[model samples]
Target chain A: MTVRVLLADDEHLIRGALAALLALEDDLVVVAEAATGPEALAMARAHRPDVAVLDLQMPGADGVTVATSIRDELPSCRTMIVTSHGRPGHLKRALAAGVRGFLPKTVSAQRLAELIRTVHAGNRYVDPELAAEAIAAGDSPLTAREAEVLECAADGAPVAEIARRTSLSPGTVRNYLSSAAAKLGAENRHTAVRLARSKGWV
Target chain B: MTVRVLLADDEHLIRGALAALLALEDDLVVVAEAATGPEALAMARAHRPDVAVLDLQMPGADGVTVATSIRDELPSCRTMIVTSHGRPGHLKRALAAGVRGFLPKTVSAQRLAELIRTVHAGNRYVDPELAAEAIAAGDSPLTAREAEVLECAADGAPVAEIARRTSLSPGTVRNYLSSAAAKLGAENRHTAVRLARSKGWV
Candidate 1:
């Protein structure tokens, strides 16, 4: 049986390429394509594809939101999250949203087809390497405040500025920075930002 | 023949847990473990394991540095980048550093063992899902100046503060912020930060 697949990504070239790539597979058909989250959701609801290949950073709702919507509305349409980031938080959140498959964008076209098949077959598909990384990181060390602070830090904001925006005092911002540094055991704010970013905590 | 493995991660519990997990595999032996990048590189050089699983973020140097060291010193030892983040840039850099495998920490013990075995057997491994995400994201959208500005923003610094820290004029900083907002197509700085972060650009 041919698996009906819906493709959603913001990039026109990528979306077109992926659609063309999937067209080569006899068992897979690109039933719908979308360049944004809202379009993806609308298309999925209309086409009711067997699988939805979603980009997590789309405009409007994102892949996670689309997955939750599809899961809620069309249980038969399995959702596979395709993103450029394999941040543990994204994975955790995607899984929590009931996405059956989590694939990063760097996977080869051949493997992409295989994963779609695996997920469409009612088997859970996760990048084994990503899974290992998540297990190793254990629970996220980032608190909500820390995440907020780090997110601010990623853009290279200063303590005082972060404090003002977060509605905390300058000292409190420093404390948050220091606490985050201690938690990640980073020597400085730059290193902390880099580390947190690599871990997708920011 | 036992597959010798070197493990590197900062967390003591995770290091211990991973050691225990590897011990369960009959054909795999955990030769040496390091809690930081420098130690990881030193141990990897001293005791050449068949595979080195290095965490991307560490107290010093980071996993990419360790992988490069292993590649230079002990070419026989295959490097597997194991991290909590599935950042496309990280994966791209890991591969560039001659890492044979890229895995996130979320995989089960069985899958970890399987990837180790696969890499040790002269095979390359990457999480298919992650690869797809990376491809879809295309490349880092933030320009160097924009990234610098965003880094300042991550600290929740105000426009003037970020301008001072980044050595850009306040107007320029605001321009950068506005441009970043447009690039990520975000309505405001907060959403821009969130979107850039999800794509691992910052």
Candidate 2:
């Protein structure tokens, strides 16, 4: 039985090397490759690969967004995040997005191949060390709405613009921003956005 | 005369495509390819290509740092910055590092090939649109020390650590932070860092 894989990363060398390394497995076949988030989604939809390996950060989309899109569009396709950033916030987001595997770029090629097999088998795999740190870091402080607000703010969007984009009233947007700031112990909206981004909450 | 080129981009697809595109020209040859700044530097030092095309943000070393190293090690080898980030601050930094060309990743393959020839011929080239915006953005408000302090603060480092790293006293570090914050119209260190980053000043 062959497992089709979709590999997506902004870095060319890593993607090419990973694809080559995975090709060594007789049962694993690289069906598609993408360099950006939108491209990843498009390729996944077209190829219907059994497993999608993604880098967390890309030009058009982050891993969580790509995973969410894949899960919604292709429920049978499993997704994994392979990133250099082992931050708890990133893990939390990937988990929330229903990503089946969370592995760091530091993982050996053999471990990565094994994890791919595990994920393709309809099972979840997370790095034990990262999972422990995520547990110690606790859950994200921001609610889904608050997280959305902060993420929007991180782009330097104004209150009205964020409200419009998030489909909330301006007052509601302000409330979320203020609450998020207080929760993160940030002195202002910019600080809240920065802190939330650093924590991977947004 | 065939111009030897060193291409360094973290992404594999882009680098490969660019190399292929440039190879189509009669007198352009990609002599080396690298995925990280350090590797690019090493390859450039060894190959001493006529021109080096580098992505601005890469692991191990950044484009600015790599450019500086190449400039120091191979004084005759011209360098070009090929990046997605078109911020005035990034341009300023690249120019300060003595990069001969500043081009956006959106540039057509034809234009990029032409720019390489120009840069290799010892002429300066900057994307016209970016040059206009950079001129309109005016000069950076923060001094070298203040920019350094704000950049360090962005990492959530303590004032004492930043002071030690920058070889300044703790009080001096605090003063620079506060001044940078004021200059950027930010209320705190985090906000200052965010604003500075947005403006490409840090």
Candidate 3:
């Protein structure tokens, strides 16, 4: 089956260039494209594509949130992160979110196309160096749920509001927040959120 | 097929009560339950359910974003937004994201079950009052793409950055920002983003 793809990146210049190149593939079609996290999400909804190629940093939600959301809502459409900055923490988070492919932007368009196909076929591709580097850097102790909960509390929303928004009760939300804080050795969730954001775990 | 459901809500007290009630239905199984938006997403991945019953407000991501992500990636699993605040803009956004149902939290479990079954059957169920209110409130001038892009710019990302993030050229990004500003009659994209968010248009 031809792979229908959504390409999400903030770099419009590169995005267009890549989209044009990817268009030449016989088995690939760029069905939708987005420049920001929110737009990427909207396009994904509008397209329900076979695969999504996301950038790590966008104006809004970032690649991890987009990947997580898609994983939750669109299991059939596989996702991958294409980032210029291949931080170990980021790679781990993407993998935890069930991202099938992770690569640096240096890869040629042809390589990206093949990886998209692989992802659509329910396989995974991780940059060897990136994976090794992540291993060398050790691991982010926070679980996916803990990172997600901390990300939610990023805006300093009150615990009750956070509880309401996450569907986790106030106490459970606190537990996750505290756990995240403890894992990061931060004094509180605010510090933990900042730390996590700095590390891009969230 | 028996309906597998994921229930996402912050009110653990209510969530537990509802889960217990839902457990009574022989044809329906509460396969997973989540208390926060991120947890909901995680649980959905852990258990690919037939339907996701989501609260409108969750900590990590709102119900609409969650619905959009699911619709984009998980075509097989249907989604519904259960909100206490039935604002028209939110309803419209949810519907646009391919939410199969939108209802108030005041609904009885029996009624909620029926709606879930309806969604599982690939049908839609919007609360009559909510639908009317949305219609009465008229339409949001911004298209889904526009809303999404503006939402991306909410944090005051520059046009170039927004362009990069949205995959639009700088010119196109500017146009969208200007257009959104004009539509909202705001002085600039920043104001427009603020206005759109205030109205829940983004």
Candidate 4:
């Protein structure tokens, strides 16, 4: 069976190049190209491609969010995240969101095609260097809730706004913020976000 | 006359896409593509393209270094910098380096082609938003020598080594560092470098 693929990247050149590269595979067909996360979602819904190759960063939504949306809307279609920065936290979140493959943008065209095939065949693929880095980076120190609040805070949300976004009480949000700050050895929420971001823990 | 061009960027997809875009122009031809700064220099020397479009960040040497080398090696080949980040300091440095064109990566394919033509015709091009930002950023406070010394220091070199590299006496290097630190109101050399970098002053 032919593998249908959707390519999503903010770089037009990259999207065009990936599409051109994949066109060479005998069993692969390029079905769509999207320039942003929202566009990817819309194209995915329209094309229902067998595999979605996504760059981890985009304008409207990130790769993880798009992956989650695909998993929810098109359960059979697999997702492969290709990012320039192989942040361990990103890999972890992508895995949790049920993405089937993760790779860095530095990957060669041949390897990219092979990974697409692997993911399309219902197998998982993770770049060896990125997997090793994730292992070396150790476990995430923030709990699920703590990480959630920190993500909201990282968006520059105030305590009350974070609480509203997270469906938590304002007091609970403050407690999580304080706990995250203490765990990261940060003096405040802003420093905590910066620290976590540097470690790829946020 | 047909305007020959060279495309240099670390991302293979971007290189390919830009080449494809430029191929659409009747008067423009892409003569070479490079994935690194050194590769860019080598290809420029080899192809002698009329215009060189480069990404700001690449391995080995950066866009500025590549542009400078191209100026020295192939004076007729005008250089244009296309960057994802439009930091005012980047624009300042690029202009100082005699780069003929500065653009953000968000520019459309049409605008990019037009800019290429504009630059190839021996005219200057600057992204409007970036130009506005550079205007607001005003002038860099560090003297030319001080900025040069601070750039070396940002690599974590001591004053003596910086002096050797910049062809200045050790005491002169120390005096420059002290003046820079005082001007930036930084407590130490490390803080001074950090502050200068954050402001795009160094």
DockQ (CA atoms), all models: 0.03, 0.11, 0.01, 0.16
- Per-residue lDDT of model 4, residues A77-173, tens digit only: 9999998777888899999989999987766777888989999999999989999888887787899999899989874567888888989999999
Residue B67 deviation, candidate 4, in Å? 1.3
Over the stretch A90-194, how does candidate 3's per-residue lDDT look in tens digits? Answer: 888788899999998656566777888888889899999999888876767888889778877766566887788888889999999888889888867766776
* Candidate number of the best lDDT: 4
lDDT of 1 by residue, B17-87 (tens): 56766786899999999988999988987888899988888888888888988899898999998776678
lDDT at B148 for candidate 3?
70
User: Candidates 2 and 4: which is better by lDDT?
Assistant: 4
**How many clashes (backbone atoms < 3 Å, residues ≥3 apart in a chain or on different chains) does model 3 have?**
26
Off by over 4 Å in 2: A1-55, A58-61, A82-86, A100-202, B1-3, B9-39, B58-61, B84-86, B105-118, B121-124, B144-182, B187-189
What's the candidate order when arranged by decreasing DockQ? Answer: 4, 2, 1, 3
Comparison by lDDT, 1 against 3, better one: 1
Q: Runs in model 4 with CA error above 4 Å?
A: A20-30, A142-195, B17-31, B108-114, B136-202
* Candidate number of the best DockQ: 4
True contacts kept of each: 0.00, 0.00, 0.00, 0.12
lDDT (10s digit) by residue, model 2, range B1-202: 9999999987654565567667778999999999999999999988999999999989999998999999998999999998776788889889999999998765667777899999988899998988988898788889999998888887667788788899999999999999988988887787678778766887
- Ten-residue region with minimum lDDT total, candidate 1 chain B: B11-20
Ranking by TM-score: 4, 2, 1, 3
C-alpha lDDT values of all predictions: 0.82, 0.86, 0.81, 0.86
- Give the TM-scores of the predictions, in the order they appear: 0.50, 0.63, 0.40, 0.71
Q: Candidate 4: lDDT of A131?
A: 93
Relative to the unseen true structure, what is the C-alpha lDDT of residue B55 in candidate 1, on a scale of 0 to 100? 80
